[model samples]
Target: MFFHFILIFLLISNSIQNIFKYNLFHHSHPSEPKKPSNPIVIIPGDAGSRLRANLTGKPSTVHIFCDKTTKDYFDLWLNLELFSPLIIDCWADNMRLEFNVTTGMAQELEVVLPPSRLRTMQRSFTSSALLFPSPKLWGPNETFVITPRKNYSLSNIEDFFTDIEFPQGLEQWKSESPSLIIDPPGVKVYCIYGSEVKTPEQYIWYHNWLFPDYQPYLR
Candidate 1:
């Protein structure tokens, strides 16, 4: 019995010493295990991580109480309170995904608007364009390139809608697009349209003249 106890004690002592040595080697001269190199993501220097709200005025909202955008920049992702159900509804309404084919980025919320709603939106765009004239630094002669629509212009209600019967007595379609009639002085209008996509009103076709900067790289 005494001999058996001694053998058991030796085995236990050896096992404990081996464990200690193993731990000591790793802890003392720790080697950083090989890992795949992480690729550095370089974005534009002007681009920032701040979450800002710039209202891209929608013709209408999903929720009447939901706001389109906020006035100030706020930190998101880290804000735990925003996930709450009470605050989530409002946040969700404002959170929209707009996909831009050109930039390959999610950008705009494409919502179809009847002529009635588009009328108000169209005016805002033309008026805003008038308020802020294009920069003169680009020189007196600024080239305007507009791709002509394959279908009839928005003014042609009967033809523009194709086989669909023109909705009559609902106000003239020309009124919805004042810019089409009264072209901005010194600005030649280029009418670009996709043969595939159909638009109800002229607002979208022109990309809201308010965004004049977008004219260059339209594709």
Candidate 2:
């Protein structure tokens, strides 16, 4: 609950800051003829974008169950959105316990973890990868629920639906500089995050002091 409140506050603050920045930039540079200001790209918090596995063909089975539960169980959770919250909490607890037990044991022994436990950890990570598939464990494919389902293709969604590939994505963005968008010479990027979101202290320092004059843009 506290985290949620912090997130809401951050979002509101970020919105206000963006508005202020936009106005300031526009007014300060009135002499420059504005032919079509670069499009603003707004990336939302996790699972905000719609994704599909098959891009060119008909909709394939949306893999909601993380290779753990059966399809019937997934369908059951899809039918019970209200009950899903409780079930999700339970699943989160189970995943946490699974990680602690496996990693703690490996750390104590000072040896590599087993492949099976690694696989379990990978599966647990996917539990929160998508949002539409609710209850954390069971949900439908992004395209499966629609009646007379529209032709589900990845190409149709690729323009807007991009995944954050973690350290790799970060590294690529840094190396490539500001070219995430075309038609715009330099894309102004903002990193607005809630206080509750965990980030490395060094990374925070880089963002504030060292990285590309980000302080003014970050909220």
Candidate 3:
């Protein structure tokens, strides 16, 4: 009996020593885990097919949001000629909204916009739909390259929904119908319907000058 007890005590002591060594090794020489990349993303807005508009313009801007990663590698550049340093933070915030970065490294950034300064950059999408010659700066639907802020020609609308027409009794057909006409000159009213446009008045509101026959296109 005495010999058996001695053997059991020795076995228990050896097991405890092994466990302590394992914990010590774990604490002293920890494994080096790989780090993750930032979650911020950049999205370019659609620019209209308006070439010769600006010699220099950017098609897309960097929009930074946050993610669960501890890394933050957001280095967004902007056109120095168009906006002041104060506008830099606004661009950053707008990028944040575009990317939908809810948490993580992005949450640390706090961007505050000024009152008058805010209005200066604010533009209504409706007013900007009209194309202008020699515009001061690029607005919506104007091509802007991601890097170096270079200008590029606008591409045609690839989405076919821009010119879609539905059946006569369609739920929203009443507002979707366009009144086509021709004027004294060669200018004909080719109303390309849009999804948001509900009323005929709203469809042709931009070009008030209309022609005779109100021929509606199927789409």
Candidate 4:
């Protein structure tokens, strides 16, 4: 279909821009924590995005999401990798964390800090996220298929997994199995997979597709 052709074209066109690089910084945490708390913004550079995408083999975006017991806010401008790679700097009261995307198909989720705020863990399963070049190119690929690496229930996959909606000319495709990884030292990443490739619009969809680990903020 026209959609699939667009997806392939975009994939081939990913090289249109040169890879970007960025640096990370650290801020001091408050001695005491409070109710409202402070804002936290974590930005990964373009180099980070490519490292993550290569490591996970899925399209990736970078952003910061914050929440309190009563309210939540998403600073779309804080979503750095989607636009460009820049050092996203912010402060917080009690919470401390950093994020990154690594390279290699075998994930290096290293967390050496035992009880400190820094720690890392790993899980094995099959998952996939699709990528489209642009809206003008959205379409379906006839070669798409799902492969299993371990025993599990295919029926349990989220409805979005079965949903593929690209534009007329571009289609999306991916080989499923654990292609996405979030290897922050102390923080756990909430992975959000969407039904199609599109620009970041609704804040809720952003949370759904990107911040799966922060369930408390949603409730």
Which candidate comes out best when scored by lDDT?
1
Q: Write the per-residue lDDT of candidate 2 for residues 1-219, one digit (tens) a residue.
A: 999768756765666666677667756565877686779887653321121121122122223332343333222121222123233443342223122574564221122434443443443443233322222223323331211223222223221123211343333323343333335447686868788866321112123232222221221
If scored against the real structure, what TM-score would every candidate get?
Answer: 0.21, 0.17, 0.15, 0.16
Residue pairs whose backbone atoms clash in candidate 2:
55-153, 55-154
Model 3 agreement with the true structure over 138-204: per-residue lDDT tens digits: 3435532211222222232222112222122222222322222223556665767778765321122
Per-residue lDDT of 114-154 in model 1, one digit per residue for the tens?
35444444444433343221233222233233323433332
Residues 40-84, candidate 4: write the lDDT tens digits.
876644213211211222122232321222233233232434332
Q: How far is candidate 3 from the true structure (C-alpha RMSD, Å)?
A: 24.7
Model 1 lowest lDDT segment of ten: 131-140
Residue 15, model 2: lDDT of: 62
lDDT of each: 0.44, 0.34, 0.34, 0.30
